[model samples]
Target: MSTSAKDIGRLFSPLQIGSIVDCVEPLSAGSEAGWALELLAERPELEVVPIERDGAVLGVVSRHVLEGIVESAWKRFWQKDLDAYVVPARRSVEATDYVDRIVAVDLADVEKDDPGWYIVNHRRAYLGIVNLRTMLEHLNHLRSLDLRRAGEMQKHLLSKKPDEDPRFRICFYNRMAHEIGGDFYRSTQIGEDRWLVACFDVAGKNISGALATSALGAIFACFKLFAYAGEAQLTTGLLNALVHEVNPGDVFVAAALFYLDMKAMTVEIHNCGFSPVLAFIPQENRKIACKMARPNLPPLGIEDRMVNDAPQLIPITPGLRLTAYSDGLTDMTDPFGERYGEERTIEYLRTLHKSSQADIPGLVGTEVDKWIGESHLADDITLVDLRFL
Candidate 1:
């Protein structure tokens, strides 16, 4: 694919590549292989460079290629030239064929997209080069412009706080370590004085996990119709099967689902590989850890078999508050690199309970912020506190 000088000039005008044009020097084929190897060794960052002769590109040569060529074809490569060992660069981008090396895009098509490197040629003759490193930096700059907008959308997807219910009350807190993360929770109300809460944490921390949890959160929005949260076995098994079939990865979602039966005065909890659920009873004057009915069962996407597992039942009497949260709280690191583990978390809860801090969820978030001083949070934080009247 050849380009006329007029077409090439038009692309240069659109790309404005003048600022980045002087970053590299293309090596000519006639140059000594020994000197080229020395230059490569001096600048460890430059793995490969363009090889041209008579203003025509032969191919690219890396340190490995140069060394291997010298070793295998000793007579041809070790003497003075790189002709025998210069391997062709595979097409890494939208490049045209007719090449000894990869030509990501021709000058005529440069305005179409500039994500990868381009072969700047005029009438099929090599002009200087447009490199991949500078192009990728430009692409990343363009990509970062939209992350704040995406964060706003993530915040909007969170379920509303539940305060209007006559039988029970809930306070929720969620904070992302990064601009967006995989932490999410949903609370729904079914009729007959019943309610449900499901807290989730996807496997990873940043953009990839955020995307997975965002999609999973959408599937969970279907439960807002009012009955799925309390149906622990059906909800867990269905979500397990659904995530296995839809999500394409080894990563899984760890969740604790709680179903509150105001009529029966019982809270049925399903803890699938999540941090423990703390039961705060003012009457008992202690925090009871309802760890899980089956602690060894894998997270939502591990195996295809989970029929025998069931939710644990606890009597829901006056002054009983059930708190479920993400592992981020327990695993939070201080500036000194010490972990704020389970013991600290439980003690914090007991202290708050003793002090009669009515809003435990909000106070817990504040404590986490104070603990993670001067150090960035390692994961997303989530907390859901359900107090039965």
Candidate 2:
């Protein structure tokens, strides 16, 4: 099925893109061929891509590709990872080509997406099949219709507009994921002497989480307009009101809101139920990690009441940096299922602290992406970093 640029937006909606898996690894190709067949039987609509060998495309297996190869001998011989099966590619396309070509052609006509996937080569090689879902996602973000407008909306979300402020710098980098995530950030003056900087994440990914987050931003903006808070009650009340507006099953937002006292060089932190906030101190050459006491209340909307009524105030020192992020940072699994959890997070933060580079946000962001390697993100990631100048 070919779709025009005009229709691509509807095609890549959260519902459609979420339906496709980035890649799937089948059970041993040489052993348990019967089991593999049974697996495909359960998910008949899924398209399967075989691992490539040397320079040849092997395995024509899809959910239905193995129905005919049900014999015991076939299953036993081909069940081994690469030994049993050797399906060669009859044809292939370079990844760097154009999108219109693929869209104009029927799915049966072309072996890949409109342009296909491209690697970082002078002459990039043909890199596997372009499943239907990936093609639609690529077009939805960059297609002809309202491309400029989409850029502006993302800019507004990130608050990256050039004229917003010259005193502070904010940088946002999203390395082309399937959906827009829950990372929301903002900087505004709450009092003549105080400025607020926030970095937070909502649960889930794509539009479902994005809608809740966008609404959360609206709520904060409304609160800022009507009832600005120097008091914990006001802040928690606003959080309860926002939570009450959303449905019960929705994931909650974990955030750290800082009211900076520039004159005193101090800040007050409200640890609503989220990950424990870490304060990185250079003098101690170590971190002071703070955890809110348990009996900790539910995050934001759970009961429309502050779960933990006491406010924790920590002293902020000059030359010390504050790192706040959602669980996505610590919860990511290596392809082997090892988590890049709190221990690694502190280690990485320490390494960056010693470095002479000044762009803290970008430096930490880049390292996190490299750590994940080929493993895709399962949730939205938002990191808010503040360093006193």
lDDT tens per residue, model 1, 1-389: 11222343443331344323323456877766667777777667655666766765665666776655446666444465564445443222222222212224433444443333444443354553445555556445545655676678778877555524766767778889887888888776644566667788889767777777787767766766544443556666777887676677677888887877777888888777888878875544454443323343467876675663545788877777777778899899999999999888767765654433356656776798799988989988898777767
Q: How far is candidate 2 from the true structure (C-alpha RMSD, Å)?
A: 16.0
- Per-residue CA lDDT of candidate 2, range 186-276, in tens? 7666555566666566665665556666777676676468646454446555666666667455677666666566655566676556666
Off by over 4 Å in 1: 1-134, 159-164, 190-192, 225-230, 284-297, 308-310, 354-362
Each prediction's total of clashing residue pairs, residues at least 3 apart in sequence or on different chains, is 0, 13
RMSD of 1: 10.3
Q: Best candidate per TM-score, number?
A: 1
Q: Which stretches of candidate 2 lie over 4 Å from their true place?
A: 1-155, 161-177, 223-232, 247-249, 263-265, 282-297, 356-358
Cα lDDT listed for each candidate: 0.65, 0.53
